[model samples]
Target: MPRPHGFSYEIRNDTSVHITHQGRAAATLRAGRAAAFLAEVENGDAQLVMARWTGSYKFGNERTARNHPRNRR
Candidate 1:
């Protein structure tokens, strides 16, 4: 799959992480979750990490599912 793009985050008063996708609000991580996100994001691909944190990452199943018998037109 193509690398995830258009994902960005902002830290609010050192208390939360606000994630956005293509300029729209996606999710907000608070307290412990925000702390964990900060740690992981600093060590990995930020875009991919944000996508995952927002539950938007692909699991490589779209193509297979689209071609399955039940989905065929």
Candidate 2:
């Protein structure tokens, strides 16, 4: 749950868009001003991509943490 590596994403401010390494949102893209910026992207394309990427990372991270040697029960 500690996302120590953090996520990666490319932001195209000129186009008001971004893309993750997996072709989704590279970071959390939190709600608020940042969300507002993502809203400007075409078809919310960048937003959708980021959402998927973040979700996937979080899920995978949680699964791995749950099975980690230190976390084992």
Candidate 3:
């Protein structure tokens, strides 16, 4: 199946997490706390920090008028 347009995942430092459509850091957990992390994300209580790294797609999601809203065109 195709991936959801507004949902994505990130793998960082051995942790994998699902983020929301707004690019807000939804949840994070240690390798051993995968379930806990997901629980937080799902429970709407996680305060995950926005990820900062080179090549993150978050930049592309910003409201930039330089290109098409969806494709950065």
Report the C-alpha lDDT of model 1 over 12-58, residue by residue, as the tens digit: 99699999999999999999999999999999999999998998878
**Error in Å for residue 21 of model 3:** 4.0
In model 2, which residue pairs have backbone atoms overlapping below 3 Å? 24-49, 25-49, 25-50
lDDT of 2: 0.49
Using TM-score as the measure, the top candidate is: 1
Q: lDDT by residue for model 3 over 1-73, one digit each (tens)?
A: 2222334446566565545445655445456566555565566523332232112334444455456657663
| Best-performing candidate as measured by lDDT | 1
Of 1 and 3, the candidate ahead on TM-score is 1
Winner on TM-score (2 vs 3)? 3
Q: How close is candidate 3 to the true structure, as a TM-score?
A: 0.28
Candidate 2 stretches with Cα past 4 Å from truth are 1-35, 43-59
Error of 1 at 23 (Å): 1.8
Q: Cα lDDT of model 3 overall? A: 0.45
> Could you tell me which 10 consecutive residues in candidate 1 have the lowest summed lDDT?
52-61
